[model samples]
Target: MSPVRQWHDGLQRYGLVVALVALILLLSILSPAFLTVSNLVNVLRQVAVNAILAMGMTVVIIKGGIDLSVGSLLALCGAIAAGLASAGFPVPLSMAIGLVLAVMAGGAQGLLIAYAGLPPFIVTLAGLTVFRGLTLVYTNGSPITGLPDTFLVLGAGELLGIPAPIWVMAMFFASTHFLLRWTALGRALYAIGGNEEAARLSGVPVMRVKVFAYAFSGLASGLAALVLTGRLNSAQPTAGSGFELDAIAATVVGGASLAGGRGNAWGTVLGALIIGILNNGMNLLNVSSFYQLIVKGLVILGALLFDQLVVRRK
Candidate 1:
């Protein structure tokens, strides 16, 4: 490869690492607590949900699609799980039902897009509204609480002195990394997103890949719901409001293309951590919520600007 190509590849692969190091340095300068193990673990716990969602989002984006319904899907799943558990259902059974519902919701959206020829944006947008309404209807806008400790343990319990959510995130990431890097299915997803017409011509099974992406998005949301409900010990109809944005922001900041076909699980994970640290730092330093909003917007803008610069240079 040419020198410039090598540099570009390196940036694409390790940009998240560089961004993370810079963020830690910046936050440590702002507060010594930022470097403490406890604070760092806290940030990881906070970002765990977003990171999980973003990894799912990465698959869809890699296949040149988007899933706007994930936030609502998460809320719906959490509500379902909480309601079932409260009614004395076995915790495992409740979780199973939640997973099934999530898969069905996502599969419906994928069917609309792939078979009915609906646009992904439109289908998932409809999903966003429908799932939100379903959540409210299911819970009657009331939060469900007092979940079984078994379910809660998955979300709030610890293993080896580390938070359970962190361990879940780590295992999921490792599996996803292997799936994307070593599987034929993973390569097909990239090919489809990189160029659908070409991928089809090359016999990449575009429809199957697209469907899998959406279904996986649902699965991720369901898993996220498990942790979220456990952490709060309640399930609110609006629990995941705006979570979709966080997942999207993390993917983009980690250099995933809004245009698709160029991102990774590890990069998305780092992006979530960067965002978590930034939010934690702002809260710690007593920054006004208004300023925090402005800062976040500016940071997203910076990432987009960096994307544009990289593309132009290429």
Candidate 2:
């Protein structure tokens, strides 16, 4: 490639980095408290789960698939965890069940999409409703509260002076970064997303990889559920509603192609941080919740438009 072309490609690949810096500058200008250590840590804490989920979402989207059930699945898994704890199940055992359920849910969705040949949208859309209903039925439309002390600690407790969730988020990102950067399976994920037919012909395990992606998505949601439940000190049946949109927005804003095969974990991490910072900034500035909704939607649209322009230029 020529020099100009190489420079342009570099800019496109680092679009998320540019956006993140711009957001930080804007927020610092808009809010006097934006750059403080406490607020910065708070922002990181808030973005932890979203970032974790976005990492998993990046994998699926890179494989040219979508998962709309993540939010509902979070609520479902959280509710189950809370219910189990309330019923005297040991905290560790209860969390294990939640993880198993999450993987099973994702596996089922994968089977429907890959082996049964259903569209991913339809399969996961059905899952969205099913899991939402399950959450409500299990909790009887009420929030499940009074989780064991250990359960609360999992979400709200700190490890070595850092929030447990933050630690979990860090480990997940580090591991996923390695997987995406160094493993054959990781390369195959990109290849499958780039072109499934060609990847299959090239000996990629398309079906199994697809299954693993969805399963990981579910596992991420489950982990998020644990953090959320601990933070709230309860599991609201309505918790995590509409969260999938935020995950997708984070992935897209990170420069991941909805068309597939072109993004990185770090970009998604930055994207998730941007979303977290935006929310925190709005709250600090006392932007009305209604207006905040409008602003967020506009920002998402703008990001996609920016991405389109950059892609076209490349």
Candidate lDDT values, in order: 0.88, 0.89
Tens digits of per-residue lDDT for model 1, 1-314: 99988998888677778878988898899898888998989989999999988888988888889999999999999999889998999999999999888888888888888888898999999999999999999999899987888989868999999999999889878877887899999998888888899999998888877888899899889999998899888998998898988898888888878777778887788888888889999998999999998988887888888888887877
Candidate 2: which pairs clash?
none
Give the range where candidate 1 is weakest over 10 consecutive residues by summed lDDT: 254-263
Candidate 1 Cα outliers beyond 4 Å, as residue runs: 1-9
- Model 2 residue 285 lDDT score: 93
Per-residue lDDT tens digits for candidate 2, residues 1-314, read 99988988887777667778898999999998999988998888889889988988888898899999999999999999889998999999999999899989988898888888899999999999999999999999999987888998867899888888788889989988898899998999999989999999999999999998899889988988988898889999999898999999888888788888887788888889888888999999999999988988887888788778877886
Give all candidate RMSDs, comma-separated.
1.5, 1.5
Query: Global lDDT for candidate 1?
Result: 0.88
lDDT of candidate 2 at residue 103, scale 0 to 100: 88
Tell me the TM-score of each prediction against the true structure: 0.96, 0.95
Q: Between which residue pairs do clashes occur in model 1?
A: none
